[model samples]
Target: MISRDCLQQSSLMAYKNVYQLLGVAFIVGLASGRALKADEDASPRIGIIGGGIGGTSTAFFLRQLYGPKLTIDVFEAQKVGGRTSLIRVNGEDYEAGGTIIHKKNIIYEFQDKGMAFTTTEDMLRAMGDDLLNMTRHTMNESLQHIGLSQRFIDEFAAAAVKDNYGQTLNAHGFLGVVSLMAVEPDLWAIQDGNKRMAELLLRESKANLIKGSVNTVALIKDNLGTGSVSYELDYTKATPGSDKETSESREYDIVVVAAPLNEGSKNKISFADFPRDVVTFKQDYHKLISMFVQGKVNTTAFDVGSQNELPAEIISIAPGCFFNSLKKMTPVSPNSKPDTPLKPEEAVWRVFFNKDPTEEEINNLFVSHSDLRLVDWWAYPEYQAGADLPPFMLYDRLYYVNAVEAAASAMETALIGGRNVALLAYNQWHGHFDKIDEVQLPSPAENEETKKSEL
Candidate 1:
């Protein structure tokens, strides 16, 4: 009913109103999208230094605790297994590093749950979580209290730890002595190598395993204005694909130092603004030399009537001998002839020495040095008797797993440390510090039952 001009004006006003509404909706949608992006960016990131048993286990446990939503990065300078590595000699891969894996541990507990056990009370009573905190007693003191004479300890227990871990019982704490008890009569190891376990952990974790040396870890305040702080990890990447490695830095909500922090280490990491106690924790290493030579033991040297009667398992040398322990690696087959001489590759011998053996000493052991395969020097750490080991958490979000090394350094302990830190970190995130030190381990018999069921 209105005029054409009025009609046109009304249409224009409607069109202008519609355009204004569209502009407001676009602005709101853009703001909401940015807010969502900011929330996504705030997702927590975890960084683990050292890809050994501790580091890999930390990554795996963190994933289990935090679910697949969180991102974890594990940085390793050398191989993934670190000291728990392997060596190849004459087509056979030998576990040249930490080879002990106890069955009576929590890793197996969680891996295989709800298994039966004989006298769970005895197993649990012996565990006595108190053993983990028994830092007041030295290994020697504990053994003495248990009525083990010094001579027996030196000959057997001390020799076992020294030859295997490069540390004497005197240098270890009560926790380390208890860890030695974690061994089973039917101790098992992966035939290929123990390094495969590290590989498995990384694969299971779905973590980004970066091949690099972490140089520094710096604490920084979060830019999200939430009054929160985070850790900045700086490292150099030299992984596969590109020949040229580049320096990279990343911000993490949490950081875990899994490797031993020896001052003289080649890959020492500087922690900026970390606690003085944690920064000044006792860190020391033992000198160990391992050699793999191909030869048979001189049966006459030990005065054995027959090579069969010779102690092929282990030959413990006297106190002043050139080597600590010599293990015969070539197992006697049923069809093997006792009189037949073994070929160079067929006969493998492993020797552990407290000090570096001279070439002449090596030549003296083997009938021929033509098949000598690998020789390695390791600066392994010893659990100090009364060392004031650091806590699992250095700061609010910064955790440590290697601090347990001062109490004990075993594959099981490493796994436990990794799990403990993961639990502590998860609890810290969820405001549940009460669950920090919680643990549930299976008995040896339960573990046996689990193994049988799996089989």
Candidate 2:
């Protein structure tokens, strides 16, 4: 009988070989003219737009399915971490986009393997029957079903929903509230930066990582009515705050849009002749601004004597507050060598807002370059009650990972959504698509549920 250690070692080695083969297969497939043919039978050419957790995880999971011989390409306008970015101030680094990662997210599957398991209870009992379907309900209405107090609902649950999703409980849907409740007790991040996780995912995938902004994606078909579908991606190397490069085009058997489908975003990519539903989803987006400041905070404003005595890691505000939330970050160690020198009293804090704060409002919180880092991100979808979210398969052979953002905008959701798409793509490619239209990717905490139930 095979030992557990041997099985684990073999799996690790298999994954390593898969990555190495994916790189080699991509180059070879390009040279061998692996184009859109109905029955040519060759390695598929996969294209992933947006180098965030969704896109990188798509590539990673694809490698596992197609092995080392899969041809995959990942395109990023700026860096790998779409919203998960890093900013340096006063010789310290802070997350500019995605800050905290929940252990229940799909990314931390290994750690969640030991969690206390819960079986699949009745959907009505867990989240109510109304939330089970696409029919949406506000968080207030849903929490009422659970018999929560008005004060607890207003202060704690509502505050967390607003801060985490950039929308109040009254404005968000039932799924949005579930997403907030899904946050694990322990949040995790890389020591240097949270964006490093995206970088690591890309490296593990062994995909042909290209740096460019995708302008348009068009579905190309054979004039003779062949059933095969191919995609043409037109992109340019011109990124914000970078020198512009010439526009280029490429063809792939499959295309996955990993970034948020917001028309107003800087990294927004247009789809030619896309479904009307997809267009509508792309246009509807939420507005969020992430600001990083280096200065002393008025603990008096927080009704606390010192930062250590804060009630939580974050201080979220209701509708009237100037900023959505203020998160205290770990300070840079003295041993750390940053390119810039630090001021003795400057502390790094990250603030989130639905709109830009006024000069007076900014000064009220942070005294002083100390308040410079600003990012106008379209963030996620403003999921309203009864609003419909499109499927991952936007079109044939074209997957949309950010569609899940309408329900939850966590990094775990992105990774899980991407993995589901990857599985779909793999199933179609190998003709094992029994569960083609299903979302089967388990979240980090759910991995142990099935096993514990069997016991």
Candidate 3:
């Protein structure tokens, strides 16, 4: 039989080889582990847009590090927490964007900072109160076949787990790389990513949060005659298509734009206008329509095996060969489209599609005696190859912390974007680190003791 020690040793060796191949010789350790000079004396005003996971995490981390001394304010267009928000399908709350987390990640952060989490326990509770309860798989096939930025693949692939916020591009240099490999991804592949993200957001640090919309516009050159920032912010939504939502702008000593780059940071704040900031990337987003139905929607069998016993998580809203839950929805309530609208309990297994198909064809894919409901979400980035990506770069004051910036790859990207931008902003403000400094990664706490007490 295989031994755990041997497996760990093999994993480490593989990761080391990855680093060497990617030319990341500078990253000697897992994290940069650099200590930051406290910004107890400096304060900078900040502005923001988008209140997704990235933005929220950014806001959380910023407040954690600079709080009272640093006055930070945020403005979001819609609801807070962005894509990490929850959706109600059949009366149970499910993650509309990010849905999974890993245990090793929790160990990583705890070992580094002596921090613990309640959410991990909550997730574990949902999984039989055991970290090992989650299923694991190795994705050699996806990696072998997945397309990605050559530079990114080169850098990340060197690590044991190479992850890109769902970014890939064929290389003219390494074109025609065959897509054939055995896939057996373990739980760590996804969990570690999720685990680290949760730790960073719920940091032992304290943070302040504000919500609202920010209308960005164009900026004029500083014409020093009698005026300074020439273009005035459009604080009124009086016009038909004006973009600015309100006259709300708070002050912050330092603001790291966690979301995409909009015209606001460019000195354009429109009150009544249309959002015009667009990225050149092929960003496209899709609206998700989820329908939930239980109790076997149709007489035909949808799953590969019997439904006598199955994990609730298997009823996901994605496409899979065996555990596909999208098998057409059944209408349990007969109040009828003639009497009233459908309800959540009427649907059990939820399915999402980019476009709405008729109920006739959809009906053929379900088990009998099920319920149905629909939910629409502006899934990030729109579609593959960048169809709906907005300017996740609103200068350096805000971050488009949804799947849009990192693309709707996972909840981890949305969460990580927030932490990444906050660190970048903090480093720049303290003058201890540079935003582009490749090696200036977040340092592990000085030690477990120091980390625990710092909070």
Ten-residue region with minimum lDDT total, candidate 3: 174-183
Candidate 3 residues lying further than 4 Å off, grouped into runs, are 1-35, 89-91, 103-142, 145-209, 217-282, 299-347, 367-371, 382-408, 433-435, 440-455
What C-alpha lDDT does candidate 1 achieve relative to the native structure? 0.61
Give a tens-digit lDDT track for model 2, residues 243-349: 75788999998888888777677867877754344454433777888887767665555545764564334535344555677665553232466455555445566
Give the Å shift of residue 227 in candidate 2.
Answer: 4.5
**TM-scores of the models, in the order given:** 0.74, 0.76, 0.51
Better of 1 and 2 by TM-score: 2
- Per-residue lDDT of 1-455 in model 1, one digit per residue for the tens? 22233222111100011011111232133223211011232347899998988898888777766665789999999999887776656545566776645556543343222121111122222356445434556667777776888875655566555555655566644644654553324454543456666777777788998889999998776444342568899898885786888899999888899988877677988877543444656577666777876666554444456545545445342445556666666321223343345654336677787787877766555545435655564445666665665666666677778776665667766766776676666656665534433335567799899999999
What residue runs in model 2 are displaced by over 4 Å at the alpha carbon?
1-42, 105-135, 173-179, 182-184, 222-227, 238-244, 273-283, 299-316, 331-346, 368-371, 438-455
Best by TM-score: 2
**Candidate 2 weakest lDDT stretch, 10 residues:** 11-20
Ranking by TM-score: 2, 1, 3
lDDT of each: 0.61, 0.63, 0.36
Q: Clash totals for all models, in order?
A: 0, 2, 94
What's the residue-level lDDT of 404 in candidate 2?
Answer: 65
Could you give the C-alpha RMSD of every candidate to the true structure, in order shown? 24.2, 12.8, 15.0
Q: Alpha carbon lDDT of residue 75, candidate 2?
A: 96
